[model samples]
Target: MSSTLSRVRAAYARVEAVGRPEIWIDLRPREETEAEARAIDERVAAGERLPLAGRLFAAKGNIDVRGLPTTAGCPAYAYEPAADAPVVARLRAAGALVLGTTNLDQFATGLVGTRSPYGAVRNAIDPSRISGGSSSGSAVAVALGIVDFALGTDTAGSGRIPAAFNGIVGLKPTRGLVPTAGVVPACASIDCVTVFARTLAEAEQALSHAAAGPEHALPPLPRRRPGPWRVAVPPIGQLGELDEGWVAAYEAAVARLTAAGASVRTLDLTPFTEAAAMLYEGAFVAERYTAVGPFVDKLISSGGEGLDPTVAGIITRARDIPAHRLFADQERLADLRARALAELSDADALLLPTAPGHPTLAEVAADPLGANARLGRFTNSTNLFDLAAVAVPAGEVNGLPFGVMLIGPAFTDERLAAIARSLEPRVRLAVLGAHLTGQPLNSQLLAQGAVLDGTTTTAPAYRFHALRTDPPKPGLVHVGGGGAAIETEVWTLPAEGLGRLLASLPRPMTLGTVELADGTTAAGFLCEPDALTDAEDITRYGGWRAFLAGAEDSAPSGVRGTARSAPTHPHAPLGDHPTDE
Candidate 1:
């Protein structure tokens, strides 16, 4: 066998031996695979090296791959395509070989993997849990090391949620970053082609290749920026409902950032959550019907029987929405886009949980729609606001993997990726409040490559303050010797990543010594004293999260607090471009 074929076979063998999660469908025949590899061998022999030489990849069955049948999860919906999708053609031309088409939720409707007629994709790390979906097979394929990367689509977090569950990197680029010319429509205006891989570098590489060039031709170079980074995270209380395991995981990630020297601060996520709810609960749902309603209705009329009941039900509901309602949803989405940009205005990127929680397969089966909605809680708003996102595994929770997502405005794919590469290795971190793992900003840490260490407490002498910003900001200050030990955690990061992280800090927020109860100092977030004059001291509750919980019942208006006057502290400077070192 040729070298490329042998490598692909070996990788496939490993996956088969381990009985890895569902990863392939409609695989290329061995002869075809061999012939493709031989073509690459010939090119190399001719001294023509391709950017993705001999790499193996997979495509979600919904995307067209020339000569392959595109089954969008329904046998009746299958069709043979004569041409490759623009993105697929780009990858193939770069010397990548297609291994097979991966499975997904029927028509890419659900986040839980069970909706597929092809059998539910099990979590790569645990068989009992559900792999996040509709990119289920794509995520598992990479997590199992069966392929270098895979293509999936994200209309409402199908691409990202699965990546979080499978312990891999899932890149959901800005809506149009990668051409969707050949992809089956889910919600045409918001659909995005996504990439999945074992590492951020690999996923980013694939994303850059797919998104290269002008709107039509593949560009010669990838848009990349290097150096210091500023990442905004959701303040406490705004993190949404999260299980304890996720909370611990998130806190640990934040601590890792402090140790790495990257500044982690809280921002308001109200606008994001507001926007996210609109995707499914508002007129956006009708877009799905607009794309395939006729086909579905025809199938129903013809007595066709393969459609997933849930998917059919969702599409049928879309028909109930009126034209005016659709227009109103569009206007609301526009308003949210403006608000989201303002909320995320200061930082280089926004960090949040990839999902609020991980439910078991049984739990999902019992309440598929509800469970699926929860999985997309943090992801749905991304495409609506035209943001780029990357979901990376944070660590495990009770033997199941946990993940976080990093989000940035349109075309900020490279910037979010650079930050994810830095955070990947630092799994364990300690946080005192709302930014904990599984929390809103936890995704920020996960995207940066952090893993959860564990949960603990801090020494009593320090005080935690909640700054009055829209989403809320936290300031940890070292008080004189009389304080009580506060609860905390510790996360570890690669030594090389810390420097790049430290340089991204905004003013007033600085990395400094945080005394633990054991007389040990760990890297934790601290702010300048001058900035705390108007801040609310919530040290008695020990963390910003606890304070927010108590105040939740009496929560003030969404527009209650004024944005803090541009930071006066010299240490936490902002405005450094991602392209600047």
Candidate 2:
């Protein structure tokens, strides 16, 4: 959408109306913004289908944009990048113009939006409240609608927490899905280029375009399949203390999900919380030292001001971590990662408040480290565990915004995107046999943008047979009275994804309406009666997994089976049943 030079002028007018220069460390002149907008219009006229054409976005100071010094919210460390970060280049190419580089916590440390020397990024709705950082300015820019969306980095909840505080959508893609080629590394190993948008679709589109570029150390993302979305919530006891208003809002949020045909399950918060602690309390702090230690040392030795005291202290202490301690922490992290995957194996995603609560600027100043650590309670484990997360606004609490985050194992980015979409269009599908989590064919479902909603069973009206296929498959046939309830998982996908999934299905397997244990019916897998003629009746095992476990027991230890007992990664130490971890 463009209006010659008029629309760009209007956008700048809105920028001035908000009048929060402190929110941005380096905002381009109105003339420059207009020029860029006009340029985008010219490109559109040239028939470019730039998904982000005519849109304005802000980049976190940590991310490079040519012509502007990347301050990373630290003036002492500012430097002009030779070119835009790959992610930014992709967005700009897609027709989105940059408004300016926004502020952040110095060196991308601290979750409090207040750590920046440019000035503490005030909350958009209430200036006295914290904006949530280190993506503070980027989130506020979108929160105030100053920009259509913004690019933020998520090392330890910098992206999602800010979105929660500002009441917007923050999509933190699978760790390496979005290129971080030009981002200032907070923790290079886990730093991710994240997107903040007024809507989930906007963020998803930006993600799609940005992730298409070449990347370094790209990791595999799980292909998701469709079914009922099962969301896991931490028990009240694990949520820790929050204001009465926030607690009420959280409960209401869960109730809303439950009422929306979603099955909400309780999860043990121990593993997640423990892993989160590792981000700062464990050897992971060494990562921060590795990223900025040289600069910090130079600053100190040269008599220049160093990082915000708290951040400086954290990195400084990292030097004391012995080599063996780093190895020990890695081992600890491996165990935690496995346990986390096991915890999430049964459900489509984990749902939690984006942050424990919103702290006031005054509160953060008084206890920066403590307050900031609380903000990352739900987000710190995401990157460490290599998962995808999206933060969605839920409602307000005591006049400040509250939000919930949906987190899933890696490669669930698209599925999480669909789930986070407002009024999302989707179709529910029940999946039995190989498409289940950790199964060999599960990728087929994921490739079609399917998400595992949750585990369930067919209403004692279906019989399962082990077919004699080369790779092994299950055949489910509806039986009148002698059938048994068979374990199955429900997955959900975009309506369009269903066709792709069906097209990929081989013969003997077809889509059919199946009754679930919950009295609901969904399009699911079914087999032609004739296909079961020579198949073995495995219905007595109740589910494909049970049969696999039985087969494994009869076979020698360490012998592999059709179903994966655990993820292939060495970090995952799960058993045959992922949920059993």
Q: All candidates' TM-scores?
A: 0.71, 0.71
Query: Which predicted model would earn the best lDDT?
Result: 2
Per residue, candidate 2 scores C-alpha lDDT tens digits across 1-581 of 35435546656787889988888888888888787778877876797656566567889999999999988777899898999998899888777778889988888998988886788899988998999999999999988867767999999999899998888889998877888889999999999999997666457656777787555324555554666678888889898887668888888888877766777888888999998988898888898888888888788787757467777777788878888988999999999889888888888888888888887899999998899888888889999998889998887887887898889987788767655642234688877777677775664455334556776778888888898776688888898699878877777765645765565566777888999887999988887777888899988888888788875223221212333122221111011111100
lDDT of 1 by residue, 466-534 (tens): 765544667778886865445564555433224434565555667777766556667766778887898
Point out where model 2 deviates above 4 Å.
Answer: 1-4, 214-227, 422-581
Stretches > 4 Å off in candidate 1: 20-22, 216-228, 426-581
- Cα deviation of 34, candidate 2, in Å: 2.0
Candidate 2 positional error at 155, Å: 0.8
